[model samples]
Target: MANGTGVAGASAATASEGAFLEVAGLGVTFGGLTALSGFGLNLEQGRLLGIIGPNGAGKTTLFNLLTGLVRPTTGSVVLEGRDITGAKPHVLADAGVARTFQNIRNIRGLSVIDNVKVALGLHESPSLLSTIFFTPAYRSGQFRTEQKARTLLQLLNLDDVRNLPGDGLPYGAQRRLEIACALALEPKLLLLDEPAAGMNPTETIELMELIKRVHREFGLTIMLIEHNVHFIMNTCERIQVLNYGQLIADGEPSYIRKHPAVIEAYLGAGAHDA
Candidate 1:
């Protein structure tokens, strides 16, 4: 369902590089309409990539395809050289993919730390007999899990609010907590969908610092979809632009800002008019 023009060329060029994460000829169609077509990119390990476009540019649709929320009509998603196209969300999580949504998703009544611990629990496999008998192995494993959760909270700057209910934290902190929970999965690739949707200028600035710190400290590869152009430009090493479900441009921050298609997508052809 792709336009069958530049997108094929883009996909070939991307696949030739053989990066850590490769998406080739990815497409999705609904009835007769295409939500995303020939969407492709190759991401190197441990780098930050940003995706930007106007609303309905299919940014979120791409995320859904990557995370298995939606199945693509065409193309393959390969991570670390393994084809994982159409894998279920949980299966992808087990294979080292973790994501935060555009909307905040927190366990309302759970403590900030408990929320993280809940996710961390997915990694442990203590025996039911051990749990029923209160065996040292189970108890020690639980303690270790809690300790790991606290460490993750500390890493994300949420340790001070560990005991507070997740919903009680400030909005910015809630976003960070979501990242912390995602990290509990020990993912190699992290997808953040509008992580700074409702922050003040100061908070946005802080978030920029936090994202860099997390990337540095954990050596994690991150992909984020954001409407905040300044935030994305300042934080991401590489940027990809989408419009009408096609990649208009992909390059370093400087190149993306100067790209004609990207500029046109954000501002109409007559944008320079008085």
Candidate 2:
């Protein structure tokens, strides 16, 4: 339990202790159905963690709860030791949390660079009065925002297609474009939901490296939900397996790959021996 595996019962007093992100006793119920239960985690800064599970295991549900799309019925979420249990999505974005979706959400008609610019505009827009007159300060801010957006585009290797429509890119590039938009937010904690869901082996490998490079360059704390077991095993430092919305195993990739509970949930009884 050194990795805080069964810490769903962790006391509130210790919830904020030395963790960049912490969740204790987190759960959600939709009507009479429990989507997640007693899920807890403590993620240190600059760490990469993966969440894996069979279908309907509540992996995406957890991301929604963390990103303010869904309010939890129980527990608290602490980031940098501040409680943010039920904050709104925009509030969470301002507090340094950003996420990509399972489906590509690029704006259809916007150019690739403009897609990222939209996120930058959220925080970098000049005053309304300055905007009306196109003041020097407004012009300066616009220049800075465009520069930053281009940097993000280059980071994701989409600069070559900067002028193309967001929805016109190939499937893999579209996924990366979504990531570029998320990066424009300058987030501290980045949640990636199935970044490799629709890729061939080659594309998945490329995305895996891209994610690692981003993590290294930005010093970001990343938590991803991925179904590609090979990608998760290689990219993440730690893995948490969920079964029926509950944590069945939490540890290094090697341990999680061989855990009994994980084997049973993912492959059925005795499948590990087969």
Candidate 3:
């Protein structure tokens, strides 16, 4: 996992294959308290990055800041070399970033295909007027987009239930469907918040493989926040550990597992190198 997801060494910029996203000096505050401080990260394209830490470490809060679900009091979010700090959620989506919630939030009543279509239409639609008329060009565009959606569904092994309501699919399938919805946006960067949450061990393993395949097959740059330390270590190339709203460690998993500060602050004294 470290081999696949590791951050490029210092001099990441000059290393060629530069970072797709660079988060620098990110800090978040609520009321009088700080939720994240001096936190930063560099994400290379087509890699998987794991964000992990003990509870209240601000791992999810940092993700919130990245996705613009919550604004950081101070910091800048750079995507594909563009400043996007404080950008609205929809703006970020339009800027080639897509994310999924840890909790299941896909449209429960929509058929699986329609759910994916809704997200795809945002990017592929030629015009609102065209869609309203169902003109040849409009219908033709929608057909191609739907075909892409169906192909993605099949690639995710979800076609067997393509016509099923989102809520009717099994839990594991629903999670994959949520990822499919994110993919429908044709995003360059994907943020997955605990895609394996609430899954059995078998399902978790499969999900990890699916994530890797997404990176390999689609060459997506991914940032993920996961509670399962072992799984994250096994799936992410490099990881960032947060503690009490501060960055405690950032490096390849092997280095982090042995970092004394990370052990004491985020992983606890009992955690060891994988």
Query: In TM-score terms, which candidate is top?
Result: 2
> Sorted by lDDT, highest first, which candidate order results?
2, 1, 3
Residue ranges of candidate 1 with Cα displaced over 4 Å = 1-18, 272-274
TM-scores of the candidates are: 0.91, 0.95, 0.89
lDDT of 1 by residue, 1-274 (tens): 1122235434454464557888888889989989889887778899999999999989999988988999989988999987889999888888889999898999998999999998897798688899999999999999999899989998888999899998899999999999999999989899999998999999889888988998998899999899999999999998888899998888888888877777788998755342
Give the Å error, residue 91, model 1. 1.1
Model 3, residue 89: distance off in Å is 1.4
lDDT (tens digit, per residue) of candidate 3 on 1-274: 2323232232333423446787767888899889988776777788888888888888888878877899989867788878889998878888888998888888987999889998987777687787777789988888898799889999889988999998788899999999999998889999998999999999999999999989888888898889898899999888887788877778798987777777787545766543
lDDT of 1 at 208: 85
- Superposed by TM-score, candidate 3 places the C-alpha of residue 168 at a distance from the truth, in angstroms, of 2.1
Clashes of each: 0, 0, 3
Which lDDT value does model 3 have at 92? Answer: 86
lDDT of 2 by residue, 43-79 (tens): 8899999999999999999999999999999988999
Give candidate 3 misplaced runs (Cα > 4 Å): 1-18, 266-274
Q: Which residue pairs come into collision in candidate 1? A: none
